[model samples]
Target: MFNYHTLYAELLSSLHGSPLEKWLPLLPEQINQGLCEQRFGDLADWRQVLQQLPEVSANKIELKDKIQIDGDSSDNTRAQIKNLLQALIPWRKGPFFIHGTHIDTEWRSDWKWDRVLPHLAPLENRTILDVGCGSGYHCWRMLGEGASRIIGIDPSPRFVVQFYAVKHFIQGGYHGVPPVDVLPIGIEAVPQNLQAFDTTFSMGVFYHRRAPMDHLRELKATLRQGGQLVLETLLIEGGLGEVLVPEGRYAKMNNVWFLPTADTMISWMRKCGFKNPRLVDSATTTLQEQRQTEWMTYHSLEQFLDPADHRKTIEGHPAPLRGVFVAEV
Candidate 1:
């Protein structure tokens, strides 16, 4: 009912005659697996809500400023759109504008984008891959920055649906843009040493892996020789050879496994065969950047921090300090 075959066909057409053509055979199987392996019991219900969304043509599509799909619609139509989106609650990584309604998400992903965009190589006409790209928010941003094509991968079925919801409106209104797709798969699902993308981004994902080195190596394999890698993850204040393995949870996130100092991260990147790894920016995540909103009515950064000392998490670990690093393959 989600029509993944159309998307898969589009992906194949986009990869034809490109260096990524090597992925042609394996992609279909992987996509089928991703669809068959969906664990979300509410997927059908979510798909129905998506189907209920009104077909309103966007008079203007603005991605450079914000993810806005603007057009004139009746108040009833706008309300319908808002209600449909509200059903898909806990929108984590966006502040998307549709018609006249604004769906403010949990994380101010634009802030993260601003911090990383300045330090990277030019994205104009480059093949790009975004690992752990939740809801394809940054993929839209990458497209706005003139990427030739963008492939985003995240295993979450809900996130994939959210991406396609946005994509549905964008593709219907805007035409002749480069290919942009989000696959429901993990980094491990990708073939090794594909060496296809001109630029690769792995943000907010490194610390979640138990074997950080293997994750780094996988990222390296996705890039072409000398391609740029944008690595952003949790960091602590320490010298080289220092990393934190949280006892239980860091900021209430159980999946977090490693929190490395900036120097240690650079060292690990070099060890993974990346070249000239350099720390570009390091900033502590703020409550304003990630907080509870109507669209995401869940516990957020404020609830995760220690009441006595805000600088530490509820578990007594240091608060979330994120670092952005750029390296070459």
Candidate 2:
């Protein structure tokens, strides 16, 4: 099995020259600034003798409740896609990915590049909106995958600029890729008049909202009765079907709230007017098992932070969510 931690470092190392390079270079420099002190790089040679570091636990968020998702017995593709998304999860939280691959710098022949292609749903001929479109990786992927018109929305000015930078490198203009238009805005920015989208996908975003019901209602308000919404967020195992974040702030990372369970999510979706809302796919069977046993190439938000920032996890949530939700309006 590939050492997930090592593989992540290697993958990130290869992304050194991309947009993400800005943040990582400092990490190595700080370690070696005074004399040869810091110790982290190199594909092998993990021990060339360097400064010793304090002990740390990978666990960042406190589990108010254990995560549990209703696994689809037949969708093996879910696992594959989760592996693809696993590479991006670490970037969603603090100390974001400061390497290029997060925004599609080099090519990955076997993984995520074309993996989401098959699930594109021939959306090219239809209208689609991608919310919380950080770096616009998936937004760009949708265009190439066949989305006739695509709107990429995000509230991060930096992320928006970076997304455009990458898109410009590929398509030459930000005006509109003939049918693809990327807007740097929040989910609430989607006009109520544009009430229907053939499909909508929001990843790592739903949980940011503390009021799951309100979030669902807004999503439903944006979708036409027949439109489809695909949501992916954290879920606790066999726990509270509906979790209320009375004490937690939605604005945890950015200015957004955090939610709890997927069941809580599904309940909100149903309350929002979506019928036949289904948990068609998911990868984390048990949060504890996956966190403690998996020898996979990935990490949680905590792995990417320094001690000062690491202690802040006590105020947040950590439920494994690296998949999709297929819902109909």
Candidate 3:
């Protein structure tokens, strides 16, 4: 019984009479459909857990150096906060400091942010969209960097709940911050040709698509003319025109369709009508960046790689090498 209607109305109110007002009429239905379809079996239980969180005011909210929520809370209350967050296991994209508790997620998503931040157009006062934003972690960082507003889309119900949990603290404590919201939807759910955002980010998502060109086109459609596109995905070392369509699972990740070389990825971007595609940063994902943590106890990148050859996955595909590219729509 999460009041999505109220949430939708709030979103509409925030956007009313703005440039994004065109989305108001259709957004409620789209969000409702997405919420219904993506409902997890344990969604009710998750919502209950969210309700169980102790009410505490975050007197100091920090997002510049790290995502931290600081306030005066007794140790017992801090323990309660920690236990409540632990229920949302498999936290995959953050290292959020809530009160006196630290929820260390599987991926050091901050590393990825650092890599992509330097090469992009300034986010200040821009309407930003984050495709496949897990738990809205990067969206918070985008807000920290001075974005006017940000909307993140992810299909995972757990992620949506986790985002709301964090947002609860922020909104309860720090009022008057710029608007940010995470929709329970996929990239495909985005209305085609909306063309509303100043910057659109598709990170760690392109390779997961069955049809990557279509994915690129979808990313393109979300941006206005001359807007920036930040693309980050897995890549392999090879010359131009070469790409790897994983024979099966790559690094134990199913549904990973393609990993193109840097040169080839630039070519694909150009073909999709993106201008001045430039390879910005490329790095191999390391255990330090993604590994099992107390909050995310599941097996991670270390377990997926080959013991015999670290350069290859356990399934013998090339190991995880990521590339970041920036292009213009």
On residues 1-329, what C-alpha lDDT tens digit does candidate 2 reach at each position? 22212212432454366332443444343222212212223311212111111111122211112111122223443343234333332232211121111222221211332333345446646667778766565665566555655666676544443443333223322232334444435666554445656888776688676566776777776665587887777554445465534354321344345545657656667877888776765554232322211223354343423335432233444333445566787
Pull out the clashing pairs in model 1.
none
- Cα displacement (angstroms), candidate 3, residue 33, comes to 2.8
lDDT by residue for model 1 (81-109), tens: 88888888879999899877788999999
* Candidate 1 stretches greater than 4 Å from native: none
Clashes of 1: 0
lDDT of each: 0.89, 0.46, 0.88
Q: Give the TM-scores of the predictions, in the order they appear.
A: 0.97, 0.54, 0.96
Pairing residues by index, what is the TM-score of model 1? 0.97
Candidate 3 minimal-lDDT segment of 10 residues: 1-10
The model with the greater lDDT, 1 or 2, is: 1
Residues 72-180 of candidate 3 have per-residue lDDT tens digits of 8899988888888888887999989998778889999989999999998999999999999989899999988989889999998889888888887776577754488
